[model samples]
Target: MDAQQWRIDVDREVCAGTGLCVGTAAGRLRLDAGRARPVREVVEPDQAVVDAAETCPMEAITVRSLTTGEVLAPEL
Candidate 1:
């Protein structure tokens, strides 16, 4: 069976140049042009990535389960 994958997204328009996501998951995310972006669109499931998404002050980061299409971060 294939391992699960997660999809990370950051709304550039909503991002406020906060580095929280990058700080939370440095290896999985980075700051580009003062905005946070995922190192890769799709990645292996990672808690740090989820945490980063959850902690985004602008609520700009989003993490989803690729296999299930379930939103994984920024709990509503």
Candidate 2:
């Protein structure tokens, strides 16, 4: 297994499940029954993940740098 490089959180209640994040970061995000969730609780810090968070219509996805505790997407 690999160490988690980033922390990705999806607010299911806030997620509209429009698939914007999933579409942008298919490998990181998935939609189940119109509820959006991370493929896993943690993932390698990737640009696609950031893009997914940025493109979320509801701003429900949050990506943070595990090392720096910095919010990478949605620009806060």
Candidate 3:
């Protein structure tokens, strides 16, 4: 089976330091300098991460497909 690759990116410029992503996706997202940052450039974000992205009020978190360039969601 192909390893489904995923990536989580946080737009620090737009981030409001809400800490929602960190709270939602503690495994993949963290609060840095009051902004959200991805723990890794590429991560197989579990459901929590996806849920976190959805919960971002600023919509700063983005989840995308690494190989296909398909945006999973603007905020998830």
Model 2, range 1-76, lDDT digits (tens) per residue? 4445898999899998798888788778888988999988678868998888888888998888777778878787
The reply for model 3, stretches above 4 Å from the true place, is 1-3
Residue 52 displacement in candidate 2 (angstroms): 0.8
Q: Give the poorly placed runs of model 1, Cα more than 4 Å off.
A: 1-3
lDDT of 1 by residue, 20-66 (tens): 88889988989899888888989988899888888888899989888
Pitting candidate 1 against candidate 2, the one with the higher TM-score is: 1
The TM-score, computed over Cα atoms with residue i paired to residue i, of candidate 3 is 0.87
Point out the higher-scoring one by TM-score: 2 or 3: 3
> lDDT for every model?
0.87, 0.84, 0.80
| RMSD for each of the candidates | 1.3, 2.2, 2.2
Tell me the TM-score of each prediction against the true structure: 0.91, 0.86, 0.87
Best by lDDT: 1
Task: Give the C-alpha miss distance for residue 3 in model 1, angstroms.
Answer: 4.8
- CA lDDT of 56 in candidate 2? 84
